[model samples]
Target: MTAAITPTTREALARRIADLALAVPGRVRVAVDGPPPTAPVELAEAVAELLRAAGRPPLVADARDWLRPASVRLEYGRTDVDMFLDGWLDEGALRRELLGPAGADGSGRVLRRFHDAGRDRAFRDDYTTLAADAVVVLAGELLLGRGLPFDLRVHLRMSTAALGRRLPADLGWTLPAHERYETERSPGKEADLLVLSDHPERPAIRS
Candidate 1:
């Protein structure tokens, strides 16, 4: 079992992310990737908070918000591995509505959210103009190896045992997809930063 992360360590991580946000002169995009049970969303929130406190406007985009419609996600059945691996997230929609606009080459205006998966409807067009030094944090599972433009990439990793222990029974079907990701994409090797997240309270930065 991993040791618990001290409060000091958590703060340090937040500061590190904040520094990365300010490293570039223009809009910066960051990705925090991990399985849902690993709670990468919490890390994104912490980073965003730190950036805002440091006088930078930060936007947090949740992958869940950009998920494809229920019909599309359920096409191969709710528990289909292929659906979880490839068909779940609407990568095209994300590129069009959020990533493209916030990218370095594109306009700095980003749509905070695009669709509501639960309601399976389009979200209201709430576009925000990012400052030249603003930061965007996108959090989700399997976010790496997708060729998305991100200035900083962080991957939270858990062992197979840890994942199985943390995952709910209903969501257990997605385990194989994650396993495939670990073997094929090797996010830990691809990420700019890798966090050993078997024990959420005691996460450690892996070399």
Candidate 2:
């Protein structure tokens, strides 16, 4: 069974993100939890489905890949947070980590490009980084419309079941949740959106 994110851990992460949002002007925060083997594609697909399920506005870009003339792109990878916080690396490292080039550049030119971009942020995990990037993009758009003094937060959690549930159903692979095979499970992280939806002080949706 995948170990669940304990209540304490969730609270800590939430608080950490909340603190970050409060501190950084025009910044966004996001948190995500899921099984370790979750593919990047599965993560992308689930975010798309969740947006639809939640009736969220259409994302400025398609979740599958880059959509257009956007300069800031998001690539997914793990990072050493301390090194990032210490300002040892720049955006180039982050670009290479998040999105370099489609194929291998034998000359490592893309890596050099990433290194040139100037790294302003970093994350410890790929999932969290993806969530943060989505929020950052959304936050930038919101700034153009609503102006500042706002904090944007997004959380994306994927499950082998929930993310890929539609597939097995389509393929006629009928197995109960209890009986289905699960690998690299996160164990306890249930969806937090339901809890937030029930929050009495939940923030109103912004335009």
Candidate 3:
């Protein structure tokens, strides 16, 4: 009998293995999708480590590296929730430089970082060639439902109260964007792996 697919179980795969390459062949582009307070970066690193242990190369990158210039990002206003949901990330550059190039037929040369949001300037980094079977782990907030091609989509879900409680007071304005994301994108349904991280001590995986 076939195993019922869930967040913790695939047909022939289990949550413990973490050999995600079996799920997606050749070069894989994985999106560690979550809001900022959910800390997608940490989960990304863990995924990379698992790949490394399994003798696969995993290149961890952040979407913040491809953020649009503050001028464009803040055109409507700094706290525009719509802009936060849609316009902040430079998806075109992200596709051109990193995710697109990591595809099966794409050139192995991948651009590591493109833009620096801190100084609001471009990064001075050379292109690095990714191994044929390497995994590109891109972590960031609001990554899903944008039509980006990712082999494995892992969404770190959190409750509204959890998000508000963990998020810093200054960044409270960004909550509406996440709310919009839930209503519009339906990440829980779209994600390949869904993890409920409301309680930091123990995250529940759907059975």
Off by over 4 Å in 3: 1-17
TM-score for candidate 3: 0.89
Query: Which stretches of model 2 miss by more than 4 angstroms?
Result: 1-23, 29-61, 67-135, 138-155, 162-164, 168-207
Output the better candidate (1/3) by TM-score.
1
Model 2 lDDT tens row, 142-186: 111111111333333333344345334442222222122122222
Ranking by lDDT: 1, 3, 2
| Best-performing candidate as measured by lDDT | 1
lDDT comparing candidate 3 with the true structure? 0.80
Q: For every model shown, what is its TM-score relative to the native structure?
A: 0.92, 0.22, 0.89
Provide the lowest-lDDT 10-residue window in model 1: 3-12
Candidate 1 local lDDT, 15-44, one digit each (tens):
776787777777888999999877877878
Residue by residue across 13-79, what tens digits does model 3's lDDT show? 2233246554666899988888777677776777777788787888999888989999999899989
lDDT comparison, 1 vs 2, better candidate: 1
lDDT assessment of candidate 1: 0.83
Pairs with steric clashes in candidate 1: 4-202, 5-201, 5-202
Instruction: Tell me how far the alpha carbon of residue 122 in candidate 3 is from the true structure, in angstroms, after superposition.
Output: 0.5
Q: State residue 133's C-alpha deviation in candidate 2, in Å.
A: 14
Candidate 2 has a TM-score of 0.22
